[model samples]
Target: MTKAIRSPALVVRAFNVEISRIQDQTSDPQTAAFRLQFWQDILKKIFVKEQVFQNIPANPIAQELFKVSSAYSLSKRHLEKLITSRRDLLQTKLFRNLEDIEKYADDSVSSIYYLLLSVANIANVHADHAASHLGKAQGLANILRSVHVANHHKTVFLPMDILMKNKVSQEMVLRGVNTDDMKNVAFEVASRANSHLEKARNISVPKLANQIFLPAIAVDSYLKKLQKNDFNVFDKQLQQTNALLPFSLYFKRVLNKY
Candidate 1:
């Protein structure tokens, strides 16, 4: 019953897990592409009212997603964008500037928030705007936290503009070399993320949509940590979630404050 009640959340969680699995487990691009295509096809089926699945989807996640689709008028484009962004990440794409990074965040992060809003039947323009910025903030903060691991995996999320301006080299980032330039670049990106977060907070969220922004509390905490660390991307401690993160998120959710 609990699982049935939270099927939408489960679907989102399962999709994210599959993405992580592709990144961590799959080595061949062709194989990864096939896997992503499979999910894409399944999503298409889910969107169609009569065609739930050509074959019964054995994957629990897909089943849950199908259930949610039946229950709510979920946006197919937003859900598809989530998968597309993950597919894009499979092929290396260097972010050219802050705009590039923001676009990526919007595609990868904002799309999910929009889907969540749709699940809650939130249609207000202001809530949508707030969710978009909040998604950016959360996405950027997440990348900031994973910089060390991503660098080690030869993945770069920092914008080229920031790296160039700060004279931070790709090799330096890939090898986890901590430098003043890297710190500066992190500082700029973190600053931009915080600005988006502030913008999100300033907007009035509808009472029904308040819980959708619960992730904001976590994003806010991460921004504060980055500030405390002087925006050091290589700080090992930054990888750790705040000790009180669960409690903080719970409190914020219960209080209906993002």
Candidate 2:
């Protein structure tokens, strides 16, 4: 499904339209102002962000999206961190261990969670809970998706606790062996991260789970596809279904009602 919009241009349009819709739903001047400023920041990040969109092959669509989005200075400091730290991240060798990996995590998508808040029409009172919950979900999903690629690069991502308990070594992970303890360690890392996710949802705020709704459902959809094909994300051969997002819209609606 993926929003029924495959082309990169259409995808950018879809995201812009969705942001506008969320803003209209908010209908508050404060929310409106924040939304405006927030998206302006996102657009800026789109072109300037080296981690996600850097090295994208030159194409008409890529040029258009980058041109339109990278127009302003990001308002949040962490969003600034994503921009400022772009050079540091390029030096992959520096992040050779778990501690370094967590720092990398903080640099990349954890900061993106800050941008997601900037764009969403969620309010101040709800901000803390909203951010924490949504961040953990997105962060976990990101870490899961990029696990293999990261390991290949000599950057460590598994929690320090899991690494210690399982007696796994950084060199072993980079070597890419799927040891039993390693698999268990990865699962434990995810499970512990989910526990943090649950903690973030403890508050009874309106539209609290809305941010994570689509991602959570996408995770389930991806997991099901993996099961059917006898594939796992860590194995790298299991690709996510394009239809995942379309079926996930229903779940998003339900969670938004939270």
**Candidate 1 at 212: error in angstroms?**
1.0
Top candidate (TM-score):
1
lDDT of 1 by residue, 95-193 (tens): 788787687789888877787777777799999999889988887887777778765467777888888888888888888888888888888888899
Report lDDT (CA) for all predictions: 0.79, 0.50
Clashes of 1: 0
- Candidate 2's C-alpha runs over 4 A off are 1-76, 84-107, 150-154, 208-213, 219-233, 236-238, 254-258
TM-score of each: 0.92, 0.54
Worst 10 residues of 1 by lDDT: 1-10
True-structure RMSD for candidate 2: 12.0
The local distance difference test score of model 1 is 0.79
Estimate candidate 2's alpha-carbon lDDT, on a 0 to 1 scale: 0.50
